[model samples]
Target: MQHESASAMAGHARQHYQETEQEHISRSQSGFPDFEKDMPSLVNRFSFSLKDNLSSYLGSKNPFYSNVDPQKDYVWLLDNTAYQNRIGRWKAEIVAAYFVKNSGKDLSEVVGYIADKIGMAKDEKVEETIEQRIQPLLDSILPAHAVTIDLQGVDVRLGPSGRDGISTDEIAIPGHGYKDDQVITSQAVKADATTMRTHFASPKGWAVLSDIDDTIKKTLTASPIGILKTTFADEPEPIRGMPELYKHIVQKLDSPPFFYLSASPYNLYPFLRDFRETYYPSGTMILRDASWMNLAGFLSNLTQGTEAYKVDRIEKVHTWFPKRKFICIGDSTQTDPESYGEIYRRHPKWIGAIFIRKVTGVAEMDESTKNDPERFKKAFDDVPRNVWHVFEDPNELYTKVDALVQTAT
Candidate 1:
């Protein structure tokens, strides 16, 4: 875990940033606006004034407040999964995000907004105090472009970040004789820069592709206000029995690699990453790429075009691990069933089992429709009923998971 000094890392990042700025300048001199390089800044500038005014008028430091410091920023390297390619080389996709620290303000304004949206805003000091505790969740994203990060302890060099302040690159690890599920962490070659862990998964074996909202954590995605409360106001709560069920999955599946795929945007990576570390097996989280500027985008990220987004990400995973049998797990609150079904149809043999949680009892949701077997049946149409199971409880999957192991044996 040894890393370069903070000064060294910061210098490297600055060099890259300058080089990228030069390129943007050249492009702009050619008579183009360089919109890709400038739009994020414009949006951030506008949003800052708007949020500041709103916060001032309301006299509250809200979750949506955007106070960015261009001079100070940090890199966040997301956890990734590596696999051995056909040429006997280990390869992994490195994803990183850049951001600046936000003003450490009470996020009670988020709770207040949610309360007002649902007509629940009141003088309940107890509830307000509870929501303020999650203030750490609010971080100002650095809308940086072309920021490069060097790595230590691995053979990977991430490309320059895009307009959204995220960079993704696929690099081949130069070594052999690595253990299966070997965990390798790449530290930033600078001080205080984020480090990422890559799990080396063998080319063949079992892997779990699970969802985040409502599958393992209580996200309440069916209701917009519930979504906001759980995401911004309240502490993340794991669905009952899911932590144990995931542990059982690890034991029965022989500690296979897990991929927690979600439709949530990448800004929530740290928050979701903490939740995963607390209750589930360590896995690479595949999240949406959009770095949204407003609170509305959060809800839209969960509900809009999610089926297509999940399908596309799963396809990328399939490309990386074509031989591995996958167990797909998701909930009924959104498009998990449809997304999983679409992938399963395309590669029937690649997927071994599909589990869909029959989400129910959440406020403001059409529970009867969500829990109806007909919906699952329609969603899984053209797929084998024996291959997919819908359940209300995590305990119901223990024997089913054991059965998959036996079938594989």
Candidate 2:
């Protein structure tokens, strides 16, 4: 029954992808003047279309080509966590992007859409300025192709940004005696870019892999209107008792490295990073790489193929730190159960514990399935029953986390 349901869902997703791609191509041809100019060649368009379709099918997004004026564009450096390689050397994965700023008209249209979606009155005044609230959404990405970034004081020059306006480089740290969890602040030598890199020594210690949306921060993913309101208009709110609980986990496990895993697109990096720094432990944020051109993609990002997306990322993390036990934290609002369960099955020893927040009070969610014990049981089939937990209150996990730590020791 579950297999059939999954197959049906996958088919629906593929159908939706085809429809959306056609819509996007139509919009580009009719509306976007720049898109046609940038993708002038039929061959180029075909190639990009092929890649884009393939990426979407694989539950990811490919970076499209864009003409960007360097004078008008800026770079965003994303924070990353560093790990020591098997060769006993430190390495960091740096991800940066080049983007042209959106115009006031663009911002206004987005704000209007968000307002209309959430049924906000035109005269309503939010606590913060509209610009401040919508800052993360204002980037028009440019393919700052082949632009090198110099990591100041580290003697590492990161290789060029790809056609997606983003560059991801894994470079070895030159120094030998850096402390575990020591933060290195790197600045781009030429561009006005700065980002932090947190180093984790190669040690067989406990680490955390936490979901964002409803796990720590309250993002009402189940409700479309709720998602728009909370994401664009309202201040981000942390789930009650989660901050302290994370702090307890950190202290109990001697400050294990944290990975904030989310299906949210990378555009929300700065916004989510600020929320994490203010409330939770500092760790690497693993966000989806897709940059969407419209508002609808935001909701799609939070809802689509999240199980496979998360499983892929967790496998990458496992490759990095196979010896480190992980405590996976997520909410029932999405596919956390299935994703975590799959990861646990693949690497039973690598996962120390799994906690799924049994989210409630969201009227839009299908509570019957989301809160079903049989669903969880099926998701976590063949795994030890004690290894995975579903709880309503964050407070309930305090003792469980402590017990896990004690058992690990």
Candidate 3:
């Protein structure tokens, strides 16, 4: 009983801290809410009450979303494979983010539609962001030091490896070339352990670090409408042949670890993670925390700080496996060419290859390429010709990664 109270108290404290910090970031970006709570109401209490009552009426009538009362979830768990030496010395860490969503059914879909019509829905949803309420707390039910395999079973606190990352604890594994079929299973999760296997690591410690959008999935990111449809409305679609290419890379590396680094907001973590699991091999997924406004705000969130964001994640991944060589995969639709190029310049010895897809279909990208070829060219000018390749089709990646593996061996 005491433990339960302690856990509950911790949760509230964490939630308060998160809200305060995020509010500061918000103020920096767009300033605080137009009015303070103590200040006189602009619309007055009666006017706000009337609007809420009307919204409730509309929501009750329309039944906008097909499912009205789906189950609410507070815990989201991401599981992936990670790599380390046989003796529990990690070669690379598997990073998984734990996030909670304000139940999807916070208000009826019709309520959201109304909010959208009124230009206030986005703000309302942002306020529902996971960090706004859910706090990290110890699972009081478990004895101290004990944790649960379930993402929500414990209060999760991530470590410093990532801008937001959790540290993996040491798991005992004997010296290898000892076995390939080795696997570990625990009835309950330990304090610092995440779900991953160490036996699948590449023989030479080579890892594939890839981006999620455009390169592997059809984000059509250049189009905000496209981004909305793909990210939220439609099931994610994979880029053709890319899965086969990634699988082939894994096969050739004898099961090298895969790290997916993206600037996609954390809110979409489950959506993207499912796509990766279905199409690509399991690996750690790193994502950023962001709020969803309407479509325009959604697009802005993906691109804001994206270049610097990638650099920071890449540096963090590199830190995890200082001795391993990496093959980076990204698309030219954004600043990937520039970002990867800069990474190569700084850490040429650490990179084995860089692949950037020649992204097309969006009008802005088409115009950018046609209008100024130099922009793309100069992004890679500092990068070595042998280290990077830009291909529109995935087949080219197969041939290149194939060659890279064969020649290295």
Candidate 4:
């Protein structure tokens, strides 16, 4: 019954307004509401009621209407939500005044207006960012180190070394003209470690250093402004299978033997935190510089083209944990291979292995490293055997290292 009555009342009000509008149009054809002269009596009758409803609605939405002392008839229903936004962004005085006057509470008194409006509560949802989420996870395994090896684009042509046709030395045989008196020079040969029987283990005080973009996560080619907006405003999407791997590394491997190294700038902390919260909530992070991108800095990329910022980070890790061995993992698409190779050469005992991700854009590894079992033995130079393995995906490494982590002290 109440719904029916309300419907009837609306219909009657519409009819009355149409009749009044038609009559007003016929008289002057101005199609305007001249409040000062026309409909003075009607205003006197309904103006108070209209003003009251508007004020009531606005007041319930916020406390700003309480301080407004305008005459009941003078009020107009205007949306002030965007006006407040404009006041902060464009600094328009008139728009700001309307928001201030119509709103009872001072704009300055509204704490967490942005977060509140967006429904992002710091304690509940928005607190965990990619950097913060990953930080503790990384910190728990704090002794991480990485080594990237670049093969210097060396060719892997196979066959015997030192041609057979070049004759220089004349030999004097003890038994002249004898059938077994001939002396010949042969090329050096060695066996690959993969075929050799050995007991393997992860060294003490070890951590894993890794590349960021394309190795563990997808790289979004964002500009500086885009990066800033993402860090300070937008959330990030995490890579598949990363959260579980991180948790396993933390809970299984534990702390002081695991860490992360990346070339991404430090300004991306917010995005990092966002990624972590969405996936690995307890992860740890270590970021690089907060400065603008420099073209000159990019020149340090060794083989697979990496950001030069990672070089400093890798060096820093070696300096901080000089005695700790780092099992480095990165993609062939960047300098992970070359840089890690350098690290292995410099500190053989401190670097356990260089695992390269076989990627499309990077240079292909030597065929001998891919095929011959013996050539692999001499490639490590002075480093320990089985310290270099190339993989297509980063996740594959956990399987090989799982035994080491399970038995770790």
TM-score of each: 0.76, 0.81, 0.62, 0.38
lDDT for every model?
A: 0.68, 0.68, 0.52, 0.35
Q: Candidate 2, residues 82-140: lDDT per residue as tens digits?
A: 78778777777777766555432356555665676567748357524444666555554
Per-residue lDDT tens digits of candidate 4, residues 154-215?
21111110011001111121112211111221111121101101111122445667666555
lDDT of 3: 0.52
RMSD to the true structure for each prediction, in A, is 13.2, 8.9, 12.9, 33.5
How far residue 196's Cα lies from its native spot in candidate 3, in Å, is: 6.4
Colliding pairs, model 3:
137-155, 159-166
Which residue window of length 10 is worst by lDDT in model 1? 39-48
> Residue 250: error of model 3 in Å?
2.2
Reference-based lDDT, residue 320, model 1 = 95
TM-score for candidate 2? 0.81
Query: Which regions of candidate 4 are displaced past 4 Å?
Result: 1-204, 220-235, 280-284, 290-308, 360-385, 406-409
Q: Give the per-residue lDDT digits (tens) of candidate 1, residues 1-409.
A: 2232233245334433433332333333332233223211112312223333334322122333332233565667889998988976888888877555444242445556556654557858635643554332344433322233444344344534433445677877666787887897776643345667989898888999999989999876455555666775567899999999999999888899999999787867878998999999999999875544335545545655677778889999999999999999999876788889999999999999999988877665556766678878887899998999999888889889988986552
Tens digit per residue, CA lDDT, model 3, 1-409 = 1121233234334433434232234333332222121221111101112232233223223222121111211223344443554444433332333222232222344234333433455665532432222122110001111123422233333221211112233333323443332444322233333244333453456788889988899876454334444554445689999888888988887677788888775546656767888999877777764322122333444645566678877997765566778898988766677778878888988888988888776653443552245755776777778888778888877777777766453
TM-score of 3: 0.62
**Predicted structure with the largest TM-score when compared to the true one:** 2
